[model samples]
Target: MNDTVVPGRGDKGLLRNRVVEVENLTIRFGDFTAVDGVSFSVRKGEIFGFLGANGAGKTTTIRMLCGLLAPTSGVVRVGGLDFDDGGNGIKSIVGYMSQKFTLYDDLTVGENLDFAAGLRKLPAAAAEKRRAELFGMTGFDRPLTAKVSDLPGGIKQELALAAAMLHDPEIVFLDEPTSGVSPAARARFWGLIRRITAVGKTVIVTTHYMDEAEQCGRIALMRAGRIIALGSPDELKDSAFPGPMAEVDFQGSDPAAPIERLRKAPGLLALSPHGMRWHAAFSEGALMDAALSALPVSVRVRKIKPSLEDVFIRLAGGAQ
Candidate 1:
């Protein structure tokens, strides 16, 4: 019924490896608070994720963590260096791939990488060597002469990832990397992300897809620019609905009587319409059993697992 923040779980060794830390981080734009008093830490080699609807400040928080925008308040540390409104230490260890495709359409694949290397100021030989390694790492089979516009959405996505990793930054920030790619492509892109962690690099990604969010080791759910829930997917779900859930569909067209009647039912935790049916959450099995029995026999009640959407609806006040 309240914000869920579970203590860190899984792999004891990794739990101690804190790579990013933030405390009371906040930023405002005149009369608006884009990111409010948020605090969380990311472990080394962890796939940390931020999930929220638009205007929830997911990007604003990411920007602060990446040192692109200095926070109005709070302490931030990346790789154990105090990032108190500084970019020097942050830039050397963080790679970023934005939600939008950043490669030049007219330029060839090689040219794009070259441009990225120039921006990073990598030497000619070092840039070439890193390119070869990244190509092998991402399974990039496309020829260097291939134009960016000629490639598919998935391929371009991978290219963007490769370019982000060109400098071998310790942490990678992926902002909706697979937003428009096919499901298979999304799956493949995730695999690439997994490999990045396998080799001991940390990743912080923001995704709208619930399934994609499930892949994260830990998640911070944001609402109104504040993290309402912080935990793994299962932890958040269990904490959100510490009871039974049921989907009920009325047999008759006019079912207002039962709907209004159940609103005041004792032990009823939540009741709301979801499309053609209504979803209900009860404090326990005893309450759920009694509630179901009190409903009209013509109505159909099916128990269901609580999902992230359910968590969002219950926690964020409404749908995004």
Candidate 2:
């Protein structure tokens, strides 16, 4: 078992037990490489974030782990066993929820849970017990008779999660679970994620939301079918952009004008708009002097921390 955490785990160090291991993982389709030499390990009881833009191979990687798709190359180990030898066991121990809602719209919450339990072959009495426990865990108060389609987006997502966990899977993969939900709903959904980990279940999530990425114990940033960056959020930020960062607010009619001007300035590594202000990064030492001297005195500039988005933009070569 490889215990090392690539670039390293975060401050909490909650992800100490390794469960999923991928090495030199690659998948191809004719002339296109869907996943190219991707490798990473996920720890038990940790929230591992898999981040990338659309078509960046995040979903492809997840599919391989779930045994839904076979990799063209590389080794995938789950639960201390290889996928090839443990494919059936892996299927029984892991749950996957795709981006789209998979539950029947006309099915009630309880009915869906029952169907899920049937898929898992849970005994009738055990299924009832697990259903009640999941409802309590998710704070789902809707009537058992209420249709899933009539529920709010947040509640529907909750039901979907409950259905996935009906089999008591040790590892769960959520592909863009909070894609179309409100901020409040997203927050509530993250709360559910925390609860899942608290019970000793490991979660692997793929999300476009940076804020959601911040919640993970560690993340593997993928791009062009490869893992370009891997580490805790803070570690990735520091590693991606080692130089100092500044936020400048100028009294101007157009934010784009300052951005364009700063882009051509000497020693300016990268600059992007941040709400009413603009965040700029400068290289270390003497380079900072030139980048700052070029700024207009009329603008208000202050030192600021480099954000994960800034780091991603720099490492991924563009904003995702």
Best-fitting candidate, scored by lDDT: 1
Per-residue accuracy of model 2 over 103-216 as CA lDDT, tens digit each? 999888778888888998999899889888988999989998899889988888888998888888899999999998889999999999999999999999999999999999
Cα deviation of 205 in candidate 2 (Å)?
Answer: 0.3
Q: List the residue pairs that clash in candidate 1.
A: none
Q: Quote the positional error of residue 28 for candidate 2 in Å.
A: 1.1
* Residue ranges of candidate 1 with Cα displaced over 4 Å: 1-16, 251-255
Question: lDDT values of the candidates?
Answer: 0.88, 0.84
Query: How far is 304's C-alpha from truth in model 1 (Å)?
Result: 1.8
The sequence of per-residue lDDT tens digits that candidate 1 reaches over residues 1-320 is: 11222246556665468888877889999989999999898988999999998889998988888878888887777777655436677877899888876899999999999999998999989999999999999999999999999999999999999999899999999998999899999999999999999999999999999889889999999999999999998898899899999999995567799989888888888887888899898899898888889998889999998877777678775544
